[model samples]
Target: MKKLFLLLLFTVVVLVACASPYDPAPQLLPSYVKNVYVRPVVNNTNQYGLEDKFTKAIIDEFMRDGRLSVVTTEEEADGVVVCEIKRYVLQPLTYDENMVTEQYKLWVLINVFFIDKHENVTLWAEPNMEGIQIYADSVKGGFGGMTEEEAREYIWEKLARDIVKRTIKGFGSTGGISERKVQD
Candidate 1:
């Protein structure tokens, strides 16, 4: 009985020593930041009207999340999200026997930053946030595929979700391009 008791005690000790303590919900954002304002997107690329659509998408995403209030003005917000559309590249990925493009890859790159309104400082900046979609060109008759506009809408949705997730879930939650290779 004595030996059994010691063995049980030793097992319990070892188990306790090997166990790791983890907090299920580690606080990622400051408590004071409850409202965020998404500034109008600035499009640096030559793609026209991309800023408006992307800006609306991000704002809609934040509203849909409902975790933080979306404010119209900077003064009313505790945080501000600034976005710049850096690059838009659409290229033919696959071609048919007649040299007709069948599939195309559309990639959009943007730089996003979260700024602390109170401190007037950027908390985080994702410089190479990118969204890409490869699809069959319906115009090229690739089995009734999607149009460029449709593919762009898909990209916007995904990037918007990623932006919202990054904001709500904190750093390292979403992945983006590490280094930009887009040249002038």
Candidate 2:
């Protein structure tokens, strides 16, 4: 019985020793990246001024994160974040008794990338990144409903938060296969 107990203990120790932690993906943002310059967001959709709104939102999020300083120009930045708005979709969901729209779904698609200015190489890119939100139209009671501007703000905030989170976490460390390639 003593021999069996010792064997079990040895087996446990061996198993524990063999256990290894999960290896995360490589860091996309190098440690030298101190300031990030947010370029003007290119707007592909017909929505005028959306580019400015998204650009402002992204800059605000980066500032809020405080991981990297936001620079005004590429010359002052160690890295640059380029974004292109690809699509904007709004779909009416439910309808009121008079055929009035009562609910809507808003979706925004964008392509974003981070480039190291000194090396002039892409650190990471999230093509086709999407943000979506659902909102109700103003009802008779004027409750549980939001205006289009309100919905837009909500979606923008969420997207900015996501972008900042992904950027600050070193890009590829998000526990998934990154489409962006790293330079050796």
Candidate 3:
């Protein structure tokens, strides 16, 4: 019994010594981004209204993160985020010529640029931040296709969330927060 107790005590001591303590580091923000400027998104695509949707989404992302202060104009900001709508397409769904169904998929593509003014650097430029959402054809049949306005609303919300999440993760990986900011 004495030997067993000693062995157990020794095992506990070893286990305690082997365990590593958590040491939190200091939080750090991006070196180049002190202030962010969100430009009015330009729509260069043939599809109408996409430009507005993308622009609003990007701005919403900046607001949600609340990490960097946003500026109205690029000249006033330390970093500028410029975006463009590249494509917006809704393909029709038809089972046959005689019997047409109301269902469609909406696709949207946007280009995003993060530029640093002071450093004259382009931190990130992605030409393809794209998303797709499906909508039914008619409200009555429970299979109705999405109207243009409805599709816009759906796509905008989805794009905003996606852009916000991706940007936050990217910023974090690039040292958006200091070690001290990380919760235990």
Candidate 4:
């Protein structure tokens, strides 16, 4: 019985290892989409300088991704990514001793659109998309915890990655992106 169980386990492992990876979302954009320009994000919320941070993050991410080329102008690019900051909110999440705020959450709602410059049409749009992060506050005000700017940076990184993934791999993708190279 032990010998049979071992054989069964080995067979299962082999099958699992040999199985192909699945892709949940289809490639909606054409293969020619290589050069991309990220527009300066418009901020509707009252948070000063927040849009600039998000825009810079997205540009830096696209340049680092290596799959898409980041261009300086829309006229010179194959596609453009437009973003708008719809809302920003910071709320206290946890309380420590004496009802002091210990943890806080930062949330932002954004609208995004990927436009094909040649076609002059939007390839896809994600409106009212939200990103959030939670961090503990410093006890004394400058040491062992995260500040508002740090939290925003963390959230910006997350949003930028998601935007790049959606634009390159297609929105709502579940599995890993199969294609790695983009035509120049």
**What is every candidate's alpha-carbon RMSD to the true fold?**
7.3, 5.2, 8.9, 6.8
Instruction: State which candidate, 3 or 4, has the greater lDDT.
Output: 4
> lDDT values of the candidates?
0.84, 0.83, 0.67, 0.83
Of the two candidates 2 and 3, the one with more favorable lDDT, higher being better, is 2
Task: Give stretches of model 1 more than 4 Å off.
Answer: 1-27, 172-184
> How would you encode candidate 3's per-residue C-alpha lDDT over 97-161 as one tens digit per residue?
55665677788888766665766655565668887877776653554556757887777777666
- Candidate 4 regions exceeding 4 Å error are 1-25, 139-144, 172-184
Which whole-number lDDT from 0 to 100 does residue 131 have in model 4?
A: 92
- TM per candidate comes to 0.77, 0.79, 0.66, 0.76
The CA root-mean-square deviation of candidate 3, after full C-alpha superposition on the true structure, stands at 8.9
Lowest summed lDDT window (length 10), candidate 4: 175-184
Expressed as tens digits, the lDDT of each residue in 1-184 for candidate 4 is 9999999999999898789566465756678888999989999998899988899999999988889899898789998889999999999988867898888989999998887777666677788889998888865463568888888999899999999988877753443223333223
Best TM-score among the predictions, by candidate number: 2
* C-alpha positional error of residue 183 in candidate 4 after TM-score superposition, expressed in Å: 28
Q: What local lDDT score does residue 179 receive in model 4, on the 0 to 100 scale?
A: 30
Task: Give lDDT tens digits, candidate 2, residues 72-175.
Answer: 88889998888999999999988889998889898999998877777777767888999888888765444688877788888889988988877777675654
Q: Write the per-residue lDDT of candidate 1 for residues 1-184, one digit (tens) a residue.
A: 9999999999999898789654354326667899999999999988899999989999999999999999999889998888999999999999999999999999999998887776666666788999999999998777859999999999999999988887777743333312332111
lDDT score for candidate 2 against the true structure:
0.83
Screening candidate 2 with a backbone cut-off below 3 angstroms (N, C-alpha, C), the clashing residue pairs are: none
